[model samples]
Target: MQQTTVAKTVTYTGIGLHSGKSVTITLHPAPINSGIIFARTDLPGIPQVAAVAGNVTNAMRATTLESGVAKVFTVEHLLAAFYAMGIDNCLIEINSVEPPVADGSSLPFVRLLEEAGSVEQEALRNIIDVKEAQTIRVNDSFITIVPYDGFRITFTSINPHPMLGVQFGDYEINTETFVKEIASARTIGFMHEVKLLQDQGLALGGSLENVVVYDDETVLTPLRFSDELVRHKILDVVGDLALVGRIKGHVIAVKSSHAINTALAKKIIESCSK
Candidate 1:
């Protein structure tokens, strides 16, 4: 497959999950082989940061990327949207340090990208195929990548809360399926965890409108799907895997989070580069 970029610029504006600030983000087409880069438009000259696993500086509330003096937080959802749309080369220009939460799902971003339109690039795309099985685990959580012909993912999430108990989903990912099945699964949180996150000075802009908050027995808003928690995990895997610079292979994830996701991506890159 060939590399891809948008045909025209697109802009999105909303509230950030952290910092609670109003933000505007613009996506511009990048040249072939440019990869995915983030530009800080609010700064003096729009400093750019490459979206690589090594740039991940924090994984507490959400994944964050940092450069010398520029940093961006909670970018996974947007990245997932781009990955789902098969856009490999783009310059994401943002007027804030954090991207807009946009209903806590990638759907809005997906919509924005669709309106931007896409074009094929001249360069052939790269794929990191797993020739051997590799796994990473932390406690009961683990994720693995094994050899496969194309992109596929199976994921599970286990939370004791009745609304978000053990759940599973499996899908062969493509541009259509990613947008239809995964993009709208909002980032979920437990009511109990909300206080902790707030205490940590995170989720500053999170609310019923932007996140799926689960109490002991029910989600605060209408349930998107019974297995949305797992689906969101799948969404996160797509976003996290985008750090590898290309989409390839199958991934099986069990209770994996940002930390394990990044670790696995790095491992795959290191292994394939050998």
Candidate 2:
């Protein structure tokens, strides 16, 4: 595959899930080998932060990138969209700490990329193929990567709630299949933890409309897939690993969180060659 970038520029606006404020982000086609770069349009000098594991500064509920004093938070969903779409180079312009929640799924960003279109560059694509098996463990959760011909992700989500129980999904990562199978899976949260999160000043823009909520009885919103939670987990993993540049691996995870996902991604970055 040749290096790729968007054919046109596109922009969108939405509320930041953490800030509870509106923000705008624009995507522009970039030159070959530019990788994914984030520019803070709202900041002086328009500080730039390269989207990579080395720059990953936070993995709270989302992936955040920081360079110097510049910070871009909650970038995983957009990164996931870029990864699944086979985008090799692009510049992301952000007006705030995070992008719009946009129903708390990657679907909106996928739509943006689809509308922008993709163009193949003259340069050949640089990929980091997994050459060995590796695993990272965090408490009871773990994520593993093994050599594979194409991108594959298997996710198992474990929730104590009876409504969630144990659900899992295995996906072959591709733009078409991703859109139909995983793109629309929204982020989920439990009702009981809302107060705690609010106390921590998190999930400020979250609501039933943006996040799927699970009360003790059941899920508040209708599920797009029976295993949507696991699918979303896979989506998160794909997004976090986008920082690894490019890869061919079969990733298996058990109850992985954003932190563990990023950790696995850092390992992939260390293991693979540019």
Most accurate candidate by TM-score:
2
For residues 26-125, could you state the per-residue lDDT of candidate 2 as single tens digits?
A: 9999998999999998998999999999998889898989998789888888899999998989999998988889998999999999999999999998
Question: Model 1, 1-274: lDDT tens per residue?
Answer: 8999999998889999987999999999999988889999899978989988888888766888999878998989999988889899999989899999999999999999899999998989887777898899999999999889988999888877866668989999898898888899988877788778778878889999988887877778777877888988999999988999765678998889998998898888888878
What CA RMSD would you report for each candidate? 1.1, 1.2
Best by lDDT: 2
Model 2: ten consecutive residues of lowest lDDT: 265-274
lDDT of each: 0.88, 0.90
lDDT, model 1: 0.88
TM-score of each: 0.97, 0.97
Separately for all candidates shown, the number of backbone clashes (residues 3 or more apart, or on different chains) is 0, 0
Model 2 Cα shift for residue 4 (angstroms): 0.8
